[model samples]
Target: MSSIVKTNKFTQALSDCIRSNPKFKAGQSYADLSMWTRLCVGLSDTEIFSMLPIALRNVWADEEIHPLLQERGAIGTGRFNVQSLAATLVCFRRTETQNSEVRVLQSQLAHLSHEFNSLSFSVFDILKRLDRLEAENVTLKQALNIGGLSDDPAGLPKTETQQISIRSDQDAVTKYVL
Candidate 1:
């Protein structure tokens, strides 16, 4: 069969399989069914049909399904099995759930990054203010003669005056103000 024919057959088979089970019908929405179909994109109809028995035995067996399949005479017809179809549906649901969780985490991380940047700017501003305050404190001490040379020039220690003058001039010029 052509690829298009095969795809159509596979689609029909999967739909029929899903309709056969009440659990799949009630639990899955149209969107969920579409997602399950998308997950089967790479598989050929023959391959998918071939997996039915194994899928039914391993993944989708239930008392209700068995009676329904028997009533329709679909059991042992070499068609799509519930287990096989369920495996694909389960995988698609899990992928969607994880993607949603990842999106939530990414948004949270972006918010945290913004908060950190704002806090960083605030800290920088505080440091600048502190530097300005320290510079003012030094200037005030000198003006009040609280920690500088004695008022009388004759009373100054000769070596200390030279060092103090040079240091104070540099401090006055380089002091940072906010």
Candidate 2:
């Protein structure tokens, strides 16, 4: 993993950023921001989200918003008070769109996982039934005295003689049971 950059001071980085992009108005609001917010630059994108400036401050004081407006013109600055931010969000009016989409995707994933597990169980059950059928087939072949029988031989087959021999044995066993 790459090392985190601790050396880029806020003032210097801000100046460097604004110099490169003349239209970037996001930096002016961040000048008096908490250090925690500044440190987040390394983790998050270089460009500020419009909502982030209001969220990061520990306090939502109106006095804080007033100073930033005096330092920079209103156009490039979004140093907003709580009331203004709430009003702006009200204008946007699609607050539930992102959250609802995420919830829908998560529920879909859960449904698919449940279906896959049930299918796996069905496959296992089929394999067990096949094994039971194979066992029954083996037992029937042994009872008929054909368990050792091979394919039709070049000479006379032994299976006919074996079945004939077992007939007498089965008759004697049946008499004993009676």
Identify the candidate with maximal lDDT. Answer: 1
RMSD for each model, in Å, please? 13.1, 12.5
TM-score for candidate 2, residues paired by index: 0.34
For candidate 1, the TM-score is 0.41
Error of 1 at 83 (Å): 2.6
Q: For residues 1-178, what per-residue lDDT tens digits would candidate 1 score against the true structure?
A: 6655755565455555556554343123556456455645666445554543444443235554555545544444333345545565556655766989999999999999999999999999999999999999878767757656656675566687788997888888788531
Give per-residue lDDT, candidate 1, residue 108.
Answer: 100
State every prediction's TM-score relative to the real structure. Answer: 0.41, 0.34
For model 1, the run of ten residues with the poorest summed lDDT: 51-60
Kindly state the number of residue pairs that clash in model 1.
3
Note the Cα lDDT for every prediction shown.
0.59, 0.48
The superposed Cα distance between candidate 2 and the true structure at residue 31, in angstroms, equals: 28
Task: Write one digit per residue (lDDT tens) for candidate 2, span 1-178.
Answer: 3222322243345444433433443332433333324334443332233333433241223354434433544332334543353343332333334667889999999999999999999999999999999999878766555655543354335588787887889999999999
lDDT of 2: 0.48
